[model samples]
Target: MGLRTIGGWLQEQHVQLHMGRWLLELDDARAEREFTSYDDVRGLAEGRFALYIGIALTLAYGVVDVLVLDELQLDVSLVRLAVVLLFACAVVVTGRAIWVGRHLQVSSVVLLTVVLLMLGTTLGRAADFPTEYLTTSCTVTLFGAIGLLRLRMHAVLVMAGVYSAVCLSLPGALQGVDALARNVAPTLGLAAIAVVIGFSLEKLRRTDYLRQREVEAEQARSDELLHNVLPAPIARRLRTEPGAIADSAPEVSVLFSDIVGFTPVSEALAPEELVQLLDTMFREFDELCEARGIEKIKTVGDAYMAVAGLPEPDPDHAASLAELALDMQRTLARLSPAWPSPIAMRIGIASGPVVAGVIGRRRFTYDLWGDTVNTASRMESHGRPHRIQVSAATHALLESRYTFSDPQVVDVKGKGPMTTYFLLGSNL
Candidate 1:
């Protein structure tokens, strides 16, 4: 084969073996966005693994230092001192790793410590000692420290290159071509393997980090959806216990408003137009409720339902709901002229004890039950167009603070004759 073709094939093999493309050449911005959670996981791993690796390296290199001195019979004080200094550095690195385990800079610090150790050990080698022995030690130290520290691939590559250069050039500077040639191939091969391993490790970490972020984002969306469907407190309870979530609110103001003459309007307008009208009016009602701190319940056809002092208690619930009903009436009056026919709402409000909860597992809904809700519905059905009807219980709460018509007896469904009033406007 031609040299060019052979070289190309070998390069391709190297690319495939090392996971194609250089480490840290990924779209770092995109990776940072998608793989932010990776920092936490990597920091934890570094914090936990750093101390152990540091201790182990200290012991391993200390033994090698003693053996080299004894066997080579070169009892150089500087060599012994370098060995001691390296061990002491390891101790400091281990302690620092433990202390700053949760920090992002720990990885960089650990890698730098390993590089310094490699430099010290190499410099302390006996003059007559074989370059091959030091080469093997440095190779294993560089690669092993990286794997154990779980350093970032880019940082690993940079440090590994610098360390490799130092180790390789030592023999070339000291003993010329023969020594350089002996260690060059083995060093390159080991460095190539280190690159593959580092890249593979980072890839795995990135995969896991992205998956965790995706899961967390999905969970947040789910929680938000649940809260939109139900009250925040009720949704929280349902999540904690997958069962019926019911509560008895002793004093809540329930308001039910229906667009007056809805039947004629529905028949006159197109389906989309009718729907748009209802949506527009109800959206106004929703805003009114939100402004007044009221909890809007489900809307049926052209009717809107809402309540106050629910999911959370409010002593001024009656007043707040009354304000909401007034705003809704004013809102419709201002916007009704744009519709095919002028719109008017018959609003009813009742204040009393009621049972509220979410029902059904498939399509859970926050709803209310009890006489208060039924009575409120009845007042709306029996109300006059453009008028706000209120039950005796509700009137009692607002009578002192708001203007209301004199008591009028209305026969409500499932309830005997009851006193009701028309809420005019707030006295305040």
Candidate 2:
């Protein structure tokens, strides 16, 4: 019914799809919506307008050819019939040009040019003598020059130059004064307009391309950041579902770890040295969390918080937490010799129902906000250095898979005396 419900069903069935592969194509489509360059817009508009003009000119030329031939009382023959057939073909070509305007592709301009050239050639052949030929030639050359301008500047100039040469040479062939003068002014004027329009259109296209690229690059960066921070499903939901918050549903296991004497250690070392040490340790910790499919919430001073069932739920949350706690202890032990001071860590893990959600209005953080979070923090504070402490709830869930030693009932501040245990090793 809905995208999220469909996605949930797919996930439940263990189906995986390469949805991210379509991101680039979607981004390109979005980029097309914004105008990046003035030149591109102008080029697109001009080309479309020129196509419509070509259609109108084609119709006008067809009507004028028939009327002029009829007014002259020209003998109707097979040759005249052929000219009519050519005019019918030109009409079809013009209809195609009108259809192509919707796409505004450069190839459409090329097609229109071909059509105009064919019409011009047919008209030239149909004229009786050199005088009639010169008149038809001048009119055809003007239309051809304008049509060629719709494509590119170089193409337009080339077509205009060839047409101009033919028109100038026509007067000599016909020995007419009016035909010679008609060739010069109109040809030069049309050539200037074509050059200006072509260059302007090219500039617009380049500007539009650059702007679109910028928008696409920005959007890609944002998507990458979102993926890095939130789980794929959560991120996608946040984007598509309005006012969706990270929901806390079933029981989840939360773990917190802190160096026993981090504050004193910080006092002894320089600021930069302390930062370097923390950076190295946290970087490794992050890697381990990722390897174990655990989510690192955040670090506050010396305390590091992580969760086992979040963004997505896992029934093996307690086992996962146990594995993480053991790994953390081993990792800290290995790094002790390299540190300025012997670093000892205490880990507290608890599995229970917690209200977890992204908190804050501006700089938000995904955090658990329930008595379960409080109990976990207390467990960490009460834990012995170099040992993992588990609450009764966690112990119950993990007792079957893990061997834990019963620790004496400890006086936990607000919660009073609570039973705790030390995680030894996994049963398997």
Candidate 3:
């Protein structure tokens, strides 16, 4: 082989000698993807990973002790001490794994490995213990580092490098070439395979975590859309049991408003300008409703609809609607100075029992049914420009808290002469 080829091979061997460096050389993009998933599912996976690894480590130590029991030609007291030390290490590592953070957990594992390595080697030298036993025990420990512990790539790699090196060096140095060849080669091969397996498992874990997050995100978005389309209580009911929604609210207040001169203004302006004007005007009305905690039902061509105390009961629903009416009048008056032409609103409000429910399936709407809704519409249609009209029901509810014009007998459509009053302002 060429010198450059030999040099490249040697460099490859050096990286294999240190698994940490090997992981660093591996695909970084793959590592980042796996880490993102690992971070997302840490709470769930940490306990599972720790439990399995703790069991594996404890079992590994037991097996090693049993295998070397007959071969340990040392003082009984020293052997007992060694056994006590190994068992104690195993117990400490396993217990700490349950509650420690990721970094500390990795540190605990490394500490256990180092303690075992030092204890085994010290005992081996004093007793003339077989190199094969020590090599096997150490190799098993390296296997557990990558295969069982399931730490981050760098942590596992650092561990594998240390144990694998000790297994390779100590056997050949103390025993012979035969021991080195038998122990080191297989340990290296197993360590490499374990690293690959660990990485694959991490990738798989990340993919499953990402999929679960995607499902949760979609569910949240669906809930948000439902809430936006319907009232909170109604939306919740629909989620639990979806069907026709028809319920009579014992009492509620409904308000309807229409632009005073929209037909003429729409004809004068371009479609975009007209739409923009309506959007701006209605947006302000929406803010006023929101501020008063009223629920906006929907807006028709040039009419806006809102309600109070239907989805949930409010004792002062009428007062709240009255405040919203005065605010709407003030909002239009302030904006009219900047408009291309004079703009005004004709508002109507009624308070009474009404049946409210969602209508249609594909393009659904939450609307009210009863004479109360019709009267509110009539209070808008038959009323004068720049005036907020209310039926006797609404007027009675707000008469104590708000000022109103003298009651007038107006000819309401469908319902002949009805006593209504014009809302002037709030007492506050």
**lDDT at position 396, candidate 1:** 85
Ranking by lDDT: 1, 3, 2
Best by TM-score: 1
Local accuracy of candidate 1 as per-residue lDDT tens digits, 1-428: 22222223223332121233465422344445334344545655554465456456655655675576554334443554554565456556646555444444445545554554444345535444456656665666667656666666766687667656656665443466765566677677777777778777777765565455445555666777887788888888887887688889999999998988879878999998878877887788887877777898998888889999997899999999889988988898888987888777899999999999888878879999999999999999999999999999999898899999989999887888989999999988
lDDT for model 2, please.
0.64
- Give stretches of model 3 more than 4 Å off: 1-49, 52-64, 71-99, 102-150, 169-174
lDDT scores of the candidates, listed in order: 0.71, 0.64, 0.70
Candidate 3 lDDT trough over 10 residues, lowest sum: 1-10
Error of 1 at 314 (Å): 1.6
Poorly placed runs, candidate 1 (over 4 Å):
1-41, 71-114, 117-122, 125-133, 148-150, 171-178
TM-score of 2: 0.66
Query: Mind giving the per-residue lDDT tens digits that candidate 3 earns over 1-428?
Result: 22222223333332121134444322234434444445534632443464455455545654555455655343533544554565456555545554344454355455646644654555455554566666565665555544444455655556666666665555244356766567767767766765776566555554554455445555666767887788878888877876888889878999999988888888988899888878888899988977888999999998999999978888899988988888888888887766678988899999999999988888787889998999999999999899999999999998988899999999887999999999998887
* Alpha-carbon lDDT of model 1: 0.71
lDDT comparing candidate 3 with the true structure:
0.70
- Measured over all alpha carbons after superposition, the RMSD of each candidate to the real structure, in angstroms, is 9.0, 11.0, 9.8
TM-score of 3: 0.76
